[model samples]
Target: MTSSSIAEQVSTFNEGFTAQIGPELSAVFDAEQQALTAAGRPDDAVGVGDQLVDATLLTPEGAEVSLATVVGEGPAVLVFYRGAWCPYCNLTLKTYQEQLLPTLRDRGVGLVAISPQTPEGSELATSNGSLDFPVLSDPGNVLSRALGIVTEPTAEARAAHTQLGFDVADSNADSTGDIPFPTVLVVDGDGRVVFADVHVDYTTRTEVDEVVAALDLLP
Candidate 1:
């Protein structure tokens, strides 16, 4: 085949492959969401103990903040993310901003959102609206990888992401590619992960009310 024809065939194949993978990924996400919903909330808290992981993350103001220090003050609500580019993460953050932050603050609990996004992207996402809490940037997914929550996307998923114009690289420049499943942890004053929920699905999240109730249980 001619060079032009060969190039055209390759492009066509990529497109077809992307199309095929998109629906499959969507189904996987849907199934995972359903399973998480059916499982309901965990009755117990997360096991972080006194050995809280210490990592520096860039805040929205471009300042470095330590995760352990933040949690050491009092009870803290830490929300982990794949990146600011994710719709589910955005929704989850917004929900917390709207619904959970006030309640948590009333009870003397600090709120923080952690992601692998660069400082610029993290600031942009938070600046778009009112996020009273700090958005921390975890470059290289160093903390997430240490927490055993980092996962690489499959080749097909990457192809589908490219076809869909989703810039995972820009979303998580520091991490290179590893993404974290959306997870939330409630840490008490003693530096323990009091409550934790990590979901395989990106669509579902812990309800804001549920988090408040969990905070209420903490001393």
Candidate 2:
């Protein structure tokens, strides 16, 4: 198959797979939300000074790296997601790559994307999405859990995933299982999170223009 055909096939497969798994995913998400609410953690609580913690991520080629190193001398935009397996994430990242990255760069901002997927998967995401920014691998969701954003998949969700032929193990070799919900955080030079959006609903995402406006407000 041609590259375009291969990409199309992947896209089609992902779409059908996501649809097949949606009900189980939704159930897990709902249960997690209820648990967090019971635990007094609001869905909208992602923010600054959250301190991403002792998390070491890898570049697409497997080099050890940290978000601190990527956030030098400028404001940084960190896009965190489960993996490239999510279509919503794929679209969101592609939109940022095609639109927001240049606009942010022009305004002296740096863009980086983080996920629980391996470097190989990250590389596939970057290449498939045409992302210019670095895609970092969070391995075991250590960074995600540190930020209080990790959500474990229910057994039903896991079974659904398996049925759909969605291999979390294959996609994120370092991760023990499924990924966290999609999140975005804007951090200033001092490592303070100036802006954050922890999406409860997988289909919804923060807009690029809204991010630009947030960046505009920073010093």
Candidate 3:
């Protein structure tokens, strides 16, 4: 059996790290999550059988790459993250890179990660995580906004971020600090969404086995 499931791993980190960081910082983070959850989540977003909308995203190298081009190629999996600054996002992306990318390549499925950070920030994340897939910058959340997953941080959350040294305003080109719901969408060649999972809680993510099972059902 696998040593630990992703949920187990994240739970362990959440418990141990929070303890190590002291209650003050931990409470701030918890409050932030609560605020986000309290803010009504987007319900009219994309769904299974719905076509994934097309948008242009900035590559790490500062070039434009369209969802049109990405979805046209065989099966594609789009992983939308909060930002490289978030530890949970880092862990999730690294996990996907280590566990999901190989099978995706073998199966001829395209994999891409998107975040609302600046292009430079996206490049930093790709390099730091050693991610082989394209890391796209969704500036101003053009795609996220269209998909109805865009969310702005609360004032308390922003203050907590400042305390944590994550100046999202400075790092993101859009300067809004708007982020997605840690979403994953699997699209077929025709741009139809075969699988769509959006985690309102940023601490969680869609697991590797889930992706494998979803891909197995693809035509």
Against the true structure, what is each candidate's TM-score? 0.76, 0.79, 0.92
Q: lDDT tens digits, residues 1-219, model 2?
A: 122222444456557764765766646645655654455434445676664454678999999987777777677888887788877688778878776888887888999898899888899889878888889898888788778777655565566567767767678756477576678888877677888877765555677877888896576
Candidate 3 lDDT by residue in tens digits, 78-149? 999888887788777888888888889899999989988999989988987888888999999889887878
Overall local distance difference test of candidate 1: 0.69
Clashing pairs in 3: none
Better of 1 and 3 by lDDT: 3
C-alpha RMSD between model 1 and the true structure: 11.4
Off by over 4 Å in 1: 1-50
- Model 2 — TM-score against the truth? 0.79
In model 1, the Cα lDDT at residue 96 comes to: 76
**What's the lDDT for all of these models?**
0.69, 0.74, 0.83
Q: What's each prediction's clash count?
A: 0, 0, 0
